[model samples]
Each structure stands twice: as structure tokens, then as C-alpha cells.
Target: MQVASNFKVLFIAGFGPIVREPSESRELYCEVLGIPFKEESGGYLHTEALQGAKTFALWPLSQAAHSCFDSDSWPEDIPVPQAWLEFDGDSVEKATANLESRGYRILVRNKQEPWGQTVTRFLSPEGILVGVTFTPSMRKEK
Candidate 1:
């Protein structure tokens, strides 16, 4: 059976683990792995220095919950995600529609973040929080 996709994925915008223990995660990525990450407000740590992914970060669980549900606590009804993966797509709306048509429950649809990325989020079968997004900053010519 062939499944149709309405949107094209341009690239992997970002990938990261959803960190429950910020100190442990920070020590691993920053101290042990030696990945240089800049800490932002609310304990968000990110870097564009990694070669494979456009953006890699230690996304705190609180932030992830806030992004998806506008709250600091993860909803008990949904499984807690272990990691996050974002694919930059040609059209977020088209991808969102395609996902819905295929029976995937979308957590958030085409929500524009404060950082200007337009994203649609859903949980994958493996419990990874996946996002189809259009990120202007990542698309810029380097």
C-alpha cells in the first residue's frame, strides 16, 4: 500500500533528547561530549556547531510541554516523549493535513514559535515527538 504525502521534506531542521535531568544532560553533551552549547533562558541549551544536524539541543521537558500545550507540565494522558526530531518541510499546512488524513494525532498544528519557526508537532510510534516545520533561520544561506 502506497501512502501519499502532500509535503516535501527539505531537511532535518533539528534533533535532540527531551531532557528530564538538565544537569546530567548538560554534563554529557557539554562536558563529556565536548559539544559547545549556549544556554538560553529557562535552561535551554543549543548549538549549531554539530555537523550532521542544522540545530541540536538539550530541550528541557518543561519547555517542550510549554511549546506543545502552553503549560509547564506534560499532560498525563499522553506518553512522555524520549526525544524530538524536526523535519523542515516545504509546507507545514500540507504536511499537517497529510498527517491528519493518515490518522496521526497532531499535538500542535502550524504553531509559530517566538523564534519564528512555523511547526506542526505529533508523537511518532516510538514515542518521539516529531515536528514538521518551516524554519527561516535554518534556511538562510550560510
Candidate 2:
């Protein structure tokens, strides 16, 4: 049975591994796979060339930590996520509420990033860092 909710995911905004080793990740995604990733500050490597996802990147663990907790280290109480996935939705607030009502503990709630994306984050059963987001730039691409 499918339970309906106010939250609606429009598309997958992004997906990538939360890399502990930047060099190894880069070597595999860029060198071995020839992903043509562009390096950014904080050792972030990303590319929009991949067809299935709007963005694909090797997101450094420290960067993910900083994004979620405003610190360079992940909280010890939380399980370290191996990768991250984002779902672009109609309303982040609604999605957040839905998740909370379903008993999911949210990590971050409707936080806007410096790069102009509003997101609510949490961890999935498989340990993937998931984000319900409203990304204006990505929506504009549609």
C-alpha cells in the first residue's frame, strides 16, 4: 500500500560517495572513469557531465560534516555515511514534516547553503546521507 503525503520528490538532484580519501576518489572517478570532474575549494570534485544525475561528485567527509553540523568532524553518535543522495522536492518543509511524522530523526532541517540550496538532511537505513532539497539552480535547468 502507498501512503500519500504532501511531500513530493520531483527528481534526483545529486548523488555521490562521501569520500574519506580525496586522492583515491579522484583517481577512480576522474582518472580511471574519466569523469572530468572540476576541482573546487575544500577538495570537492564534481561534474555535471553524468547523464542520470544532475551533479555527481566526490564529496569529502569533512565537507559533508561541515555542511550538516557546521564543524569539520562528524558526530560520534551518528553512523558515518558512505555516500550521499539528494531528492529535489516541491517543498522541503513538507518533506521534512513527513519524514518526522514517520519517525525519522532529521539531522538538519531546512538549512540554506552558501551556494543557494535549501535542504533538510537525514540518514537512511542503509547509511546514506539523504537530503530533501529545493535547489533553484537545478530547477531552472528544467
Candidate 3:
């Protein structure tokens, strides 16, 4: 088989949040963390944080809830992708604890991966899966 020569991750595109409670997610994400994000309930919220990169979008609360839990009624708007955005950090455990201490739900706790990465995951206000990870030094050899 011929090898494909192109290898790049320009966007490395990760899914953004589509919250159940736009206000709360926005408040926690923007107000609490001081991360700049816009609010758009009708269609979805788009952010300017990652320019020239992929953008994040939000959906209405009702629509998102229905989409995830299997509601009979589906929104006319396009469905948000079912994926998680992986954010690499120096301290995954520290970050996970901080979010948990603040009362945010934690879907997964800090767990060590065989590949040498510590990871944690959770649902955003909109029900989208979000994650934080750290590459453990042991995996540096690979």
C-alpha cells in the first residue's frame, strides 16, 4: 500500500460545548474562568478565542437535551458533533480537582492511561463532552 505523505494537524479540530443551560455554562466558563466566549441561544454560540482555527458552537438548551437523551422531537437545526475536545495541560489532576471543588460535575476522574497520559472528562453546560489531559513523563520515550 502507498503511504500518504501529508501529515498535519492545523485545526486539530475539537468539538465545542452545546449547553443545556447557556447562562450557567457561560457564567462558569466565561465569568468564572475569565475565558472569553460569546452567547448565542437561538442557533449556537461561537467563540473568537481560536482564530484561524476551528470555532466552537452552542445549541439551545431544549435542543441539546433532546439530542443527547433521545427525545422524540429533534431540532430543525443541524446536530452538534458527538465528540470531546482534548485540552493538554501540565497538571491534569490539579485542574480536575479545581473544577470539581467548584461543584462542576465530573464524568471521569483523573485516571492514568497506559499510553502515559493522565486524563479527566466532564460534560459542559450544554452536554458536550470536554476533557483535560497531561502527558506523563514516562511516555516521553514514545
TM-score of each: 0.63, 0.63, 0.52
Instruction: Give me the overall lDDT of model 3.
Output: 0.60
Candidate with maximal lDDT: 1
lDDT of 1 by residue, 1-142 (tens): 3546867666777667766678756764565335689889999999987656676678999999999999999999999988887878678998888778767789999999989999999886557888888999888687
lDDT of each: 0.81, 0.79, 0.60
Q: How many backbone clashes does candidate 1 have?
A: 0
**Model 2 clash tally?**
0
Ranking by lDDT: 1, 2, 3
Regions of candidate 3 where Cα sits further than 4 Å from its true position: 1-15, 31-34, 38-81, 136-142
